[model samples]
Target: MTFQEITKDEFAQFSRQYSQSFLQTRQMAEMLEKRGYQPYFVGIKQNDELKLAAFMTSLKVFGGLKFELNFGPIGQANEAELASFYKGLKAFVADHQGLELRTYPDSNYRTYDPKGEAIDQPNERAVEQLKSYGFDFVVRHIGFDEQDVVAEWQYIKDLAEISDEETLLKSYNSNAKRNVKKAIKNAVSVRVADFDELDKVEKLIEGTGEKRKFATKDLSYYQELHQAFGDKAEMLLTEVEGKAIAAGVFIEVGSEFLYLYGGSDGAYGKLGGPFLLQHTAMLHALERGLKSYNFYGISGKFDGSDGVLRFKQNFGGYITQKLGEFAYYPSKTKFKLIDILKKITGRK
Candidate 1:
C-alpha cells in the first residue's frame, strides 16, 4: 500500500462512486485552490489499484503544518487499507514537517423527522472504524460543531418518495404550502440568475448577512463557484415587482441538490420570497433527476426555539447528523505543544 498524489479528475471519479458531499467534489478543489489553499488530491493505493482518495489542503499556521481532509477519503477501505493509509499519512506529514491531520468524512450518522424527532439512530461503526486507526473525535463542542464546514446536521427531502410537483408541494407542511401559495398570489417571480447578475445577488447576500448577524463571502467567491461548477451550480433569485428580494445558492453535485447559502430581504418576509425561492430550487433539483433536495444546516435543538430550523422543517424534509469530523495527531508531543501554545496566547 502507498500514499501518492493523484490528479483532480482521478479523485473526483473515485469519490462519485460513493455518496459524496459538495465539498468533496472536483469543483470544490478547484474553487479552494483559487482561494489560495495548497490543494492536493492524495490517494491510498494497494497493488497499484485505488483504495481511498481524499482532496486535502495543506495549511502551515501557528508554527506547524496541518492537513485538512475537509470531506473525504472517498472509497471503501478495510482495516488493512486504513492501517496502511494512516502509516503512510504519518510519514507523508513527517516528511513535510506537519503536526496533525483533520478529517470530516461523510458517513452513516442518522435520520430525523422535520420536527427534529429521531427516525433512525446513529450508527457508530464508522466512528469506531476511524478510532481504531488513530482518529479521535474532536469533542470540543458539546451539541453541534459550530465551525463545521459542511452541515454536520442537515435537513433533506428525498425525491425518490415523491412522484410529481403537486405531490411534492402537498407533502410539505401547511405553513410551507400556504407561504408558497402566497408568493405566487403576490406575483413574486423566481428564476435562475445569469452570471452577469452576481453583483446584485451578492447584494441580497449582504443584506441577509447583516440582518442575520453572520459573516458572508464577497462576490468573488460566488463568481469562482459559478465558474468551477458551471451548469451544476446555480444562484436562484426571488423578485417582487421587478426588485430582487431573495436569493439562494444551490449546487447539484454528488447525489444531492444542496442549498449552500441563502440571502433575503427581511422586509419582504411577508411576501414569501424565501418560500418561492426554495420551491423553485427544489423544482430544478427534480428536473435534474437528483435523489435528494438538501435544505442544508439546521440546529439540533428540537424544542421549537430555532426559527431557521423551523423554516427548513416547513419544507417537510427529514434531518440528519452526518457523523464525521475526526483528527489524527502524527506526533502527539508536537501536537500537544502547539495546542497548548495556541490556548496560552488566547488565539484559539
Candidate 2:
C-alpha cells in the first residue's frame, strides 16, 4: 500500500462513497484552516486503488505541533489495510516532527439502544491493529476537563419510524410533550435566522456560557462556520413577543441532521423556548428527508439529573457510545511536557 496527499475534490468524492462524519468534509477542513489550523488529506492506496483516506488538522502549541483527526479516517478498511494505513500515519507524523497525533475515528464504536442494551460491538481486530501501531486509548468524560476532541456519547433520533410532527411529539417524554405545548401556547415561534442575525444567537450563547460557567468560541468562529456550511447549516431562533429567547445551530449532512450548538436565557425556561427550538429543528430535518437527528454530545454517565443529558433525553433518542480518542506520540519527551502543562493549566 502507498499513501499520498490528495486534493480536496478527490478526497470529497472518496468520502461520499461511505457513511462519513461531517468533520471529515472539505468544508470543515477549510473552516478549521481559517481558524489557524493547517488542514490536509491523505489517501491510502493498494494496487493503485484508493483504500482509505483521512482528514487531519494540525496546529502549533508551546511544546510542539499537535494534530487532531476528528471523527475521521473515513473509509472501511480490512485488517491488512488498517495496518498499512497506521504505518503510513506513523511515518507521516515522524516526517512532520509532530508532538502528538490524536484520532477520534468514527469506526471504533459499538451502538446501543436507548434502554442501555448493546446492539453492536467494536471490531476487535481493528482495535488491536490500532494498538499495535502505538496508539494509546484515552478515556474521556464530558465537560471542560475532557481530554478528547469529541464527546464519547451522543443521542441520535431515528426519524424513519415517525411519519409526522404529532407522532414525533408523542414519542417524547411526557414533560417534553407538555413543554412543547406550553411553548406554542406561550406564543413562542421558531424561525431560521438570517446570517446578519447570528449576533443574536452568539449573544444568547455567551449569556448561557456565563451562567453555566463554560467557555464559548468568539463570534468570528460562528461566522466562519455559517459561511462554510452554507445552506447545509441553519440557525434557528426561538422568540417570544419578537424577542429572541433561545437559539440552536443545526447542520444537515447526508442523511443526518446534527444539533451542533444551542443556548437560551434561563428566564425563558418556563416558557419552553428551548424545547420549541429543538422541535422545530427536528421537524425541518424530517421535511428535508433526513434519516436521523443527532442531539450531539452528552455525558457518558447517563445520569438522570444531568441537565444537558436530561434536556436531550426528553426528545427521545437512542444513545451512541463512541470508542473515544486515541493518541500517538511521535516525540515522547514533548508529549510528556505537554501533558504536564495540560494538567497544570486544567486543559486538554
Candidate 3:
C-alpha cells in the first residue's frame, strides 16, 4: 500500500464506505480551519484503491505541531492494514515537524444496555494493539468539550425498530412523552431558524451556558458549522407564542444525526421546548432514513449523577462509551515539556 495525501474529493469518495462522525468530514475541517487548524486528508491505497484514510487537523503547538484524527481514519481494513496505516501516519507526522499525533479511533471499550448493564466485554485487545503501535491510551472520563475533543460516553437512540411515529413516541419514557405532548398542547412551535437568526441561536446557547454554569462557543463557530454543512445542518429554535425558549444545533451526516449543541432558558421548562426540540431532531433523523440519533455526551459514570445523562435517558436509548483517546509522541522530550507546561499554565 502507498501512503499519501489525497484531495477532498478523494477523501469524501472513499469515506462513503464507512460511517463517520461529522468531525471527520471536509466540512468540519473547513470549520476548524477558521480557528487556525490546517486540515490534511491522509490515506493509504493499494492498486490505486483506497485502503485506509484519516482527516487530520494540524495546529502549531509548543515548537512543533500537533495533529488530531478527531473520530476517524475511516475504512474497513484488517488489523494489518491498520498497523501499516499507523506506521505511515506516524512517519507523515514526524516529517511535518509534529510534536504528537493524537487519535480517537471510534472504538468502544464498553457498551451498556438500556438498563445500564454492561453487555460487551472490555476491549482489552484493541487497547493493547494500539499500545504496541506506540500510541498510549489516555485514561480520561471528561465529557465532550474542547479539551476532551469527543465524548467518552455517548447516549444514542436507535430509530430502526420503530415502524411508525406512534411507536417511536411510545418508546420514549413517560416523562419525555408527557413533556413533548405538553409542548404541543401549549402551542409551542419548533422549526429551523433562518440563516440570519444564528445570533438568536447563539443567544439561546449562551443562556444555557449561564444557567448551567458552563462555557459556550462563540456565535461565529455555530454559524460556521451551519455554513459548512449547509442544509444537512439545522439550527432549531423552539418558541412559545412568538417567544424563543430553547435552541439546538442538529446535523445529519452518514447514518447518524446529532444534537451537537443546545441551550435553553429555564423560564419555560413547563412548556417543554427542550424536550420537543430533541424530539423534532429525532423525527428529522428518522425521516432521513438515518439509523441513529446521537444525543451526545455524558460523563462515563453510570451512577446517574449527570443531569445530562438523565435528560438523554428520557428519550429511551442505550449508553455507549468509546475507547477514548490515544496519542503517539514523536518527540518524548517535547511531549514531556508540553505536559509540564500544561501543568504550570493550569490547562487540561
Off by over 4 Å in 2: 108-126, 147-149, 213-215, 333-348
Q: Write the per-residue lDDT of candidate 3 for residues 37-61, one digit (tens) a residue.
A: 9999999998989998889988987
For lDDT, candidate 1 versus 3, the one ahead is 3
Clashes of each: 0, 0, 0
Local distance difference test values of all predictions, in order = 0.80, 0.81, 0.84
Model 1 residue pairs with clashes: none
lDDT of 2 by residue, 67-156 (tens): 888887878888788778888887787788688888886754667666556788765665666688789876544553362226567778
Which ten residues in a row are the worst by lDDT in model 2? Answer: 140-149
TM-scores, one per candidate: 0.92, 0.90, 0.94
Question: Model 3, which residues run further than 4 Å from truth?
Answer: 143-149, 213-215, 337-348
Error of 2 at 305 (Å): 4.0
Highest lDDT among the candidates is held by which one? Answer: 3
Residue 342, candidate 1: Cα error in Å is 4.5
Best by TM-score: 3
Model 1: CA > 4 A from native:
140-145, 213-215, 340-348
Per lDDT, what order, best first? 3, 2, 1
Q: Over the full model, what C-alpha lDDT does candidate 2 score relative to the true structure?
A: 0.81
